[model samples]
Target chain A: MDVQVYRVPMQRLIQGNGMPQESDHGVAIVGMGIVCSIGDNIVEFKESLKKGVSGITRLADRKGPKLSVDIGAEIKAFSFLDRLYRYSDIPETLLQKARHCAQRSPFAIQASVLSALEAWQDSGMVARENDPERLGVIVAGESTTQNYRYGLHAGFETDPEYLSPRYALQFLDTHQVGVLSEILTIKGEGFVVGGASASGNVGIIKAVQLIQAGIVDTCLVAGVVADLSPIELQGFVNVGAMVRGNEFQTPEQASRPFDEQHAGFVFGQASACVILQSCDVATERNATVRSTILGAAMNLDAVSTTAPSASGEARAMNEALRRGGVCASGVDYLNAHGSSSPLGDATEVEAIKQVFGDHVSKLRVNSTKGLTGHCLYSAGVVELIASVLQMEGEFIHPNKNLENPIDHKLRFSGARFEKARIALAMSNSFGFGGINSSIVFQNAC
Target chain B: MEKENIFSVVKEAIADVLPDVDTEAVSIEQNLKSLGANSIDRTEIVMSSMEKLGIKLPLVSFGGVENIEEMVDILVDA
Candidate 1:
C-alpha cells in the first residue's frame, strides 16, 4: 500500500505574461489619495515625492515620560474639519455626511475619512455614480485606536461610569469601515485586514482579488494611520525597533534606510487610499486609469517573531512577478521596504538579490520610508502612491540621507533626483511576524 | 439648585453634544431625539449634565426620562 503525491505544472498555472486573459477583467487603479505629514492630498504628495521632502521631525504632542524615541513624522496641526472642507469639489451633501459622521470621531477615523473622500473624488465616481451595491470598502489597519484609548484611560480610571458612550463604537478598528462606508455609501462587502507593517499591501491585494473575482466592480482600500500611543512608542524603543532621533543633527536625518549608519525605523503617520476598479468598468465609465495592478502576492514565513526572512520576501517577489506574467528583467524600478532598520534593510537587500540577480545592476532602487519615516501600517500604500508619482513624472526621488550605501552592488538612488522612465515597477513590504507582500504595477498611460 | 438653573445646565450639555442644535430655540417640552440627538448623544448629554452639577446617579435613574423638563425635574429632586 503506497501513496504518491502529485504536483501541478507551473506553466499551466501561468498564462501569457502572468496577466489575466483578454476575457478576464484586469484591475486598474483609477484614483489615489493621502493625508500624511508631508502632504494632505495627492497633488501636494506628488510634489513632495518629486522634491524628496522628509516629514520627520521632533514630536510636538508628546506625552508621558520622555522616551528615547522622541521624534517621528507625526501629522502636525491636524484639524479634521478643516481638511474635510478643503475638498471644495465634493458636493455639500457628501461634506455634510462626512462632517456629521467623523467630526467627533478619533484622529485615525477622521484621517481615513478624509483620504477616502479624496480617492472617491479623484476616481470621478463621486459624479458618475456607480451602483452602491457594486462598491466595496477594505480598511487596512488593526489596533488603530491605541492613542484614542490611551487618552480615555485617565478619565476612565477616575470615573468609569462617565465615559462617553461613543467610546464603545469609536474604539473598534472596524469603526473605520463603518464610518467610511456611511460617508461614501458603499454597500458591497466591507471588512478590515491587518498584516502588521504590511497591512496596506494586504488590503490592496485583497481589494484587487475582490474586483478580479467579480464580487464588486469597484473597491476602495483605505490604509489607516498608525497613531501609536506614547506607550507603543516606548515599547518600540525598548525593543530596539525604533530610532532615538537625538543622535541626528535634525529629525529629518533620523530615518536613513540602507545607509551605513542606519539604526532603527522612525515612526511615521499617514492615511492613504486607492480606488480599484475592473478595467472593463473603468473603460465603460471613461475613468482615467492611473496605473494597472499587474499582480500582487502575500505570504507568511510561519513565524510570529519580528525578525525578517529573506527567503520569504524573495518568494513573495518572485510569485508576484510570475502572477503578473512579468519577467525579472522587465521591472525598471523597485520600491523597497527599507524601513531604516539595519537588519530589515540588509534582509531586503538579500531578497532583492535573490529575486533579481543580474537585473539588480540596472534596476533603480529607492526607499520611500527614507522620506516618509516608515508609515508602519500604511507604508505599503504610501509607497505605492510614491512609486506611481515617480513613474508619472519620469523621475526617481532621491534617497535623502543615503550618504553611504550599505551594499555597493545595488543601484540605490543618490542624494539627488534622477530622470528615468519607469513603465513597470515592483513594490515590496515585509512585516513583523513573518508577513511578506509584493505588488507589481504597470503605468497605464 | 432651582429647576430653571438645572434646565440651563442640561441645555448647555445638549449644546455641547449636538453642535448643530440651536439651544436658545430649544424648549423644555422638546425631547433630545427631536433635536437630532442619537441614543449615544442623549446618553452623553445626561452624563455631562450630571457631572457639571457635581452629582453621581446610576444611568438607570433617567430611564423614563422623556422631555427636557422631566430630566431637569429629576436633577432638581437630587
Candidate 2:
C-alpha cells in the first residue's frame, strides 16, 4: 500500500480569517443549471458565448429617467409557468390564479422548480421519495413577490380595511423556500439566505458545509429573483445603484466593467442552481462531475453597511485560497464582483493587490457582470457557472467593455476569449451589508 | 360609456398584467380571482384601468369590489 498526499501551496498565507481548514471538508459540484440573459440553459448559454452573441436588449416601454446606458441582459423568451407545467407534467390552469394578483402562481413556482429540475437532471441523480430526508434544499431569494404581492392584491380587492395584516403576514420572505420545497419534494434542511448580492454564494457555501459535515447526502443550492417591481426599482434608484442610461446601444455593451467611463449597474433577474455532493459519492453515483469546491470563505467588512473594505476582500480571498490548499500562484483566473461601479471596482483591485501581491500580475481577471448586468442574488451562482464553464472548456471568457486595464498589474482577458487550462479559479461576491464571500473552484481532472 | 369602450379598457389592463390569459375569454361576469387577478395585481389592473379611463377613484372605494364584476360595477357607478 502506498500513501500519497497532495500538497497545495500557500505562498501568501493569512491567519485567523475564521475559514474552515481544508481537512474538515471535501465538497464537489456534480451538476449545474443556469438561466440568465445569456441563455435559458447551460448548452444554449455556451453556444451564445461561442457565437459572440449577447442576450442584452433595451426594455420596451420602460418608464424611468432616460439613462445613458439603458441596455440590460434580460431573458425575454423564458416563461417560468409555461416551462414548469410543460416539464413537470403538471397541467396549466390547475393552479388557480388568486384574484387581483400581479404574478401568476404557476410562473412563480416554476422559477425555482425549473432551475432545480435542471440541476437534478444534470447530476443524473434520481429523487428517491422513500428516503426524502437525504435530499436537502437551500434557496436564496431577494424578494417574496409571489406570496407578498399576491396577498396584498387579494386583500386590497377583497377587503381594504384589513390590509396591513395581510401585507405583513403574506409578504414574509421565507415563502420563497417553502413554495420551492413543496414543489421539489425536498424533505431535509430547508433554508433561505437573503444577504443582498452575497445570497447566492452564501447559500451554496452553506449547502456545501451541510453535505461535507455528513448532514445531507445531496443539496440543491439555488438563487432566484423575479420581476423588479416599481417599488424595488425606485428603491435602487434612490440608493444611486441603478444606472439610467439610453446609450447602452447594445445589450453586450451595456455593462462596461473596469471601463473608465463606466456608470452604475442595471438590475437583472435570473436563477442558477447547482447540485453538490462528496467526490466519493458522485463517483459511486456515476454523476457528471463538473468541478470541485476546493475552498470557500465568507466575511464581513466591519466598516460600513454599504461600502466594503479592501482589507476585508483581501482577507476573504486569502482565506479561501488557504482553505482550498492552494497558493496565490496556483490561482489561474478570478471571476470578479465587478459591478461597474467606480468605488467597488477600485476597492476589489486594491484587495487583489494586497492579497496576491506580485502574483496579481499573473492573474487573469474578468467580470461576467459585463455580460449579465448584475443579476443581484443570482449573480454569484451565474458567475460561478461561467467559471465552471471556463474550467471545463479550458478558456477564459472575455470582459466585453474593458478597453483599458485599470490596474496594469492585473491581466484583463480583454474583450475576447482566451485559451487557458485553469486549475484554480476564484469568484468574489460582496453585498450591501459588507457581507463578502469568496469561493474557489478547482478543475477536477 | 359604451360597453365596447369598457371592454377594451379592461382587456388592455388585463393584457398588461396577465398577458398569458386568453383575451377572448375575459368578460364582466368572470371571477377575477379565479381568472388569476390577486389583490396586488388587481390594484395594478385598477391603476392601469383608471389611467386608461382617465378616472380617479378614492383608494377607499376599491374596498367594496370582491372580484372583477364588482370592480366593473364600481367603475360603472363612478
Candidate 3:
C-alpha cells in the first residue's frame, strides 16, 4: 500500500520578519492533564515521581515458564470501562477487554475526555452551547482495532441469516479520534494522527497549526493508547523487541533507557491532553498559561521503516530549536526519546550530542520511559507533562533504572534536580517508518 | 425435562447473562426488555440459555418474544 506523505514548508511559518507575528498565529498551552501507570492525574503522577514509586509489575498469568517474561508497567486499576458506561448505556461485558485496545477505542476517548475537561477547567474556558463548533479534537494512535467487537455485533444483527452481527461490528476500522468525537460531541475538525511513536507529537503539532490557521478557536490535543492486547504483545515478541528471562523479574528493572544493560522497549498505555489557544486570545480571556509551545518540527527519514537514522533525528531536533528561535545553549533540559532499544537509544543520544555539541555536557537529560514504560503514541504527551512538571516543581525526575550510561559521550543526570529552573526544554519523539517529531516548550511566568 | 428443571436452567442462564441482575425478578410473565435486557443483553441471555439448556433454537424463533413465557414457548416448539 502506498502511503501519502504531507509536509508543511519550513519557510511558511518563518517568512518576512525574523520572528513570526505574535498575533499572526500565536498558540499557547493553557492547561495539561495526563493519566499513566505512574498516576491518574498530574498531582498523583508528580507524587509518584517524588517518592520514586515504580508502577511496573509482573503479569499474573505469566508466573509459569510458558512465557519468557511477565513484567510490564500495566494500568490495571483504571476504571475506564466505568467511564465509558457512564456516557452511554453499553453493557460492560459487551464492551469487554477488547474496548481497551488503543485502536478504535472508547477507552482512549474516556481518557481524553477526562484530561480535556481538566484542561478546560484549568483554562477557565466555559463550554458555551453556541461555541461547540469552535472546539476541535486531535487524537493520535497507530491502529483502530478497539471497535472490533462492536462492529461484529452490529454485523450479526444486520445479517442474522447469512452472517453474525457480532462478527461484523468486530471488524470495523474504528480509529481513536472517531470514538472521542462521538463521546465528546466535538463537531469541529477531528483527526487521528497515525504514525509510529511520533503520533502524539504529530497530533500536538497539527493541533497547533489548526488553531493558528484560525480553523478552530480551541483545540484538545492528546495521545492515548490501550496497550494490554495480546496481539500487541505478540507483535513485539515476534520482532524480538521484548525483554525475556530474569530481566523481567522486576518491572522497573525491565526498562533501562540509557543504561548499558538496556535490552528493549516495553509497551505501555497512557493518555494526555492539553487545551491550546492563541496567546492573545488566552490573554484577552485572562486564561492561565501552562506552557508555551515555542516551535515544533517533523521530518521523514525516507530511509527505513523501523530504524531511525541518527542524522534524521539530529536534523529534526535542530530544526525545532531553530524554528523556536533558540540556540542549543538555551535549552536547560532535554527529554530524549530514549526507548531503551539498543539502536533507537543510541541514535537519539547521537542526535542530541550532534545538535548540542559542546553544550550537550551541560544539558540535564533524562528519560521518563524508564518509569512509565514506552507508551507508544502517548509517550510524547507523557514526556511533555513530565517536562512541564520539571519546570513547575523545580525538579527533574531521575531515570530510575539507569545504572551505567550507554556511551561516555552522552550526559545523563546523576540525581534528580531539586532546583531545576529550566528555561527552555525540548522533547523528541521518533516512531517507526523513520518518522521524527521534535517540539520545544518554554516556561511561562 | 421436568418443568422445575427447565425453569432452573432458565434462571441460571439469566443469572449468567445478567450477573448483577436480580434473578428473582425474572419471571415467566416479566418482559425481558423491561427487566433491563437491551438487544445485546438479550442476545447474551439467549446464548446462555442455549448453552445451559443444551437446546439450539434459531435466533428468529424468539423475535416477537417480549417475556420469558414467549422465549420458553419458542424454545419448546423449536
Candidate 4:
C-alpha cells in the first residue's frame, strides 16, 4: 500500500501589517535573581564579576563512584532555610510556603525557588496587586533531576517498597513550574522547555513571545541548575566535552575562554530567574525596567550532534538584529557563549565576525563562563544577568584567563575590567543538539 | 512488635514528614489528615514506619485505617 504524505503550500496569505503594534509595548526585564558558585544574589554576583572571582575548584564529596573529572563550580554551604531567610522583606506567609514546598525537595528545586523568590521580590510583584491569571512561568532545563535520582538509587535498589511517593512528582522537570506557579500564584500558561545549554535563552525568548501575543501580561523564566551525577560527569569526560583540570596549576585557571590555552568547558552549577513583562504593564505599575529586550531569536543546525555551526549561530544573531530593527553596527557589547571549549569559542568568534562584519573590532566581547565556569543549563541566564549588570554599571568585566588572544581582530576584555558605555548588547547561547539562540537587549536604565 | 512500640515509630515518622507537628502531643486517636499530613505525606509516613519496623505491607493495607492507632495495629500484626 502506498502512503500519501500531504504537502502544504510554502507561501501562505499575507497577514496584516507585519510590524510591532502599539499594544506591543516590548518585553522588558523588570527583575533578576541568581544563585551561582560566585555569588548567591545579583549584588554579590556583580561584585564578583568586577573583581574577577573564579568559582571553579576541586570537586566536593559526591556520594557516587569517583569520576575522572574532579573540578567544577559547585554551590557551597547551601542551606534552604538559611537562604530563604536572606530575603527579609518577603512576607512571612510566602516564606513559610516556600519552606513547606522546598524543604524536602532536591537541591536543584531549592536553588530554583530561591532565585525565583528573589526575582519576585525584586520585581515588587508581591506588593503590586497582579492578576494571578495573567501571569506565566517557564522552567528551562532538561535532566535536572539526575543527581536527585542518583541519590535515591541505593535505597531503592535495596528496598523498592520504601521509595518516597513524592518521587513521582519530583523527578519530572516540570516540577519547577508547579512549585513556582503555586508560590507566585501564577495561573496562566506554565510549562517546561529544554535546549541543553541554550535552555535559558529559549525560556527568555518564549516569555517574550507570550507577553507579545497578549497571552500573558507577565512571565517568570527560571533557568534550572544542571545537577550532573557521577555518570554524567564521566560521560562528559569520555565524550571530551569537559576539562579534567590537569593542565592548569589551579582550578581557577582551568577555564580560559578565547585563549590559546583553551581546552574544554569546565562544569558549573547555577540557577537564575528573570521577570519579563510588557513595557506598558511595567509603566502602568511604575516598575523599574532593568533592561528592554529589543529582540530574541533561536535557530537550529538540524543535527543532533554536539558540534556547533557558525552559520546557524550567525543566522540567529542576524535574525535577532533584524527583529530588533537595529543594524549590526548598533550593538556595542556582546555577552559571548564562550563555554571555554576550544571549538565552541572558535565557532562563536567566527559567528560574531560574520554578523558584525567590521563592527566586530568595536564590540567588547567577554564570556562570563571564565569566572562562573560553564554553568551548562543556566549559562544563558547567568550570562544574560552578567550582561545586564555590565550595562548598568558601565563596565565590562575582565576575561579571567585570556592570556593569549585567540582572535586579535576582535576587542576582548583582558585580565582586568574596562570602562565602556553599552547602551545596546547582544547575548548568545548555543546548546548541544544544534540549538542556537541570541537575545538583543537595550539598557533601559 | 507491640502496639505501643509501633505507635512510637509512627510518631517519629509523622515528625519526620511534618516537622511543624508536635509528635509528643499526638494521640493515637488523632488522624494524619488532622495533623496536616496530606495524602502523599501520609503515605510516606506509613512507608517510613513500616521500613523502620523492618516490615513490608501493601499500601492498600492502610487504606481503611482511620487513625494512628489503627495504622499501628496493622504494623503490630505484621
Each prediction's whole-model lDDT (CA) = 0.89, 0.71, 0.70, 0.90
DockQ of each: 0.71, 0.06, 0.13, 0.81
lDDT of 2 at A270: 72
Give the candidate number with the greatest DockQ. Answer: 4
Query: Tens digit of lDDT per residue, candidate 1, span A134-177?
Result: 89999998899999999888888988888888998998888899
Candidate 4 local lDDT, A1-445, one digit each (tens): 1112122222222348774333333588999999999999999999999999999999999897778898999888999999999899999999988988888899999999999999999998978778999899999999999999999999999999999999999999999999999888999999999989999999999999888777888999999988999999999989889999887899999999999999899999999999999998899999999999978899999999999999999999998876676778888899999988889999999999999899888889999999999888888889999999999999999999999988999999989988888888999999999999999888886
Tens-digit per-residue lDDT, A99-181, candidate 2: 12213443333465566667766876643332567778887766746433643564478545434323443365555566656
Candidate 4 Cα deviation (angstroms), residue A95: 0.3
Clashes of 2: 23
Question: Could you give me the TM-score of model 2 versus the true structure?
Answer: 0.75
Cα deviation at A92, candidate 2, in Å, is 14
Worst 10 residues of 2 chain A by lDDT: A93-102
Better of 1 and 2 by DockQ: 1
For each model, chain A TM-score? 0.95, 0.84, 0.82, 0.95
RMSD to the true structure for each prediction, in A, is 5.7, 7.9, 7.8, 6.7
Candidate 2 Cα outliers beyond 4 Å, as residue runs = A1-23, A62-70, A85-108, A127-130, A144-170, A247-251, B1-78
User: What does fnat come to for each candidate?
Assistant: 0.57, 0.00, 0.00, 0.71
- What docking grade does candidate 3 earn? incorrect
| Candidate 4 segments exceeding 4 Å error | A1-25
